[model samples]
Target: MRPQLRLLCDSSFRGPQRSRDVASILREVDELQAKEIVLVAQDLASYGKDRPDELGAGSIVDLVRQVSAKVPRTRLLYLYPSDLSDALIEAILDSGVPYFDLSLQHVSKPHLRRMRRWGDGERFLRRIADIRARAAQATFRSNFIVGYPGETEDDHDQLLSFVGEASLDWCGFFEYSPEEGTYALGLPDQVPVGLMHERIAELREMQDAITAAKRDELIDQTLEVLVDEPGIARSHHEAPQIDGIIRVPLTLPTGSFASVQIVDAQGPDLVAQGADSAS
Candidate 1:
């Protein structure tokens, strides 16, 4: 079986020169006959925000269209940073792959301001609802920082509430680590290390339950999964490595698409068996 290709597009890729090179990149990938392509970007929504003309397109939506035209047969997945917008969400849904990797550092309004990011829990929840409304099978993954400078109890509570309400398919919580020459390092009221650990533990516990329940919901349902290896497969709901995997029989060949019926849920992973079709 051919190996899957992962294309990493960093912030520099958003520039005009690099943006224009996307076509050639797609052409190369096509020439290689890659069966699957995972497009990793810092912020896909900001693809052409800096200079649309250089991209030869107005937005990421146009880029998605271009990819589909160029590699219609290959499966495309996106791993992007959290800079979501209505248009970007629409574009992702249009791509027929509804997996979302939102890098929301934190969601409290004040803490988000400190983190130099935008959007609060309320705004994010609304967007999640909108996506779910449009695509019932959509899956979401996000990461959050637990203890930033000046993180208050209220802020923590807000994050807990958001975790409960969002019901994301996957979540990661990390204790803040001050980096050299960063604004956060100079901020006052740094959270104690012990407190940071405690906060992260609480957040992880809540999200774990949510993730388990989400996985449980898939039991008895059939899905089209791409077998990564002898015993590991993934449906559209699971990303390549960061999310849970669908366990399948060893008889399934690697890198082949198969229909499987989910027979059991094991926390983040699901067990499946060969099936004729989705039901």
Candidate 2:
């Protein structure tokens, strides 16, 4: 029997800054025969902020390269800084990791400030464009919070418009939940729960269309999907469960790779036939 594992590397452990010995981890990964890796940096920019030898974006990029060279068969999924630079974007494109997730809570600049985020939606849109320019196959997903304190109709409009423009392949939205001892808990004009539900529905509706359209674009394109099960496959562009799975009609051994031609888009899932065989 072979050992199976998923490497989840966090930027912070017991503190806001901690340096991970990536080489050792990769060596272990090689020994374990893991096929996928997920890195949770929380805030990539601020990673290692407290320490003198901080693990920054460059470290992640280097890790990706090493993983590719050492375990070329493994695929990577990671959370990145919301505010991305061109160098960081290019490094990611070079790493051959197809998935990119950002924590874009709100679009309106005013709303973002309320959430303590720095950038405007326009900046984020530009970043998206940058990633798309470098890697057309890049899988983009993000998380958003709707119905925050002091949210107004215009703020929602901005967020919706941003979503329309961004056309993220997959997204998760939740009504803002007030947490104990959080700054948001005391903010004025807290959104009504009823309105929060309505907003969530509307955002989901808009995103559903965009996500469907994004999925439809992959038709006829051949992707080297990793067989996760007898009937399902996943490519670099598709993450497990959240981004949904690709349906491969033929039975294939799990943990194997097959070239699949996407033939159908059933909402978030894509139906695929082996590139070498009949559907």
Candidate 1 stretches greater than 4 Å from native: 1-8, 12-20, 56-58, 70-83, 274-279
RMSD of 1: 4.0
Model 2 root-mean-square deviation: 3.4
Poorest stretch of ten by lDDT in candidate 1: 72-81
Among all candidates shown, the one with the greatest lDDT: 1
User: How much lDDT does each candidate structure score?
Assistant: 0.74, 0.72
RMSDs, each prediction?
4.0, 3.4
Candidate 1 C-alpha error for residue 223, in Å: 0.4
Question: Residues 1-279, candidate 1, lDDT per residue (tens digit)?
Answer: 443555534454324423335666667767766445556555555555556566523466666665656542233343333556566677676654678878777789998988888878888888888889989998898888888999999999999989998999999888888888777899999999999989899989999999999999999999888787778888878877778888888888887888899998887889896522221
Instruction: Give each model a TM-score.
Output: 0.87, 0.87
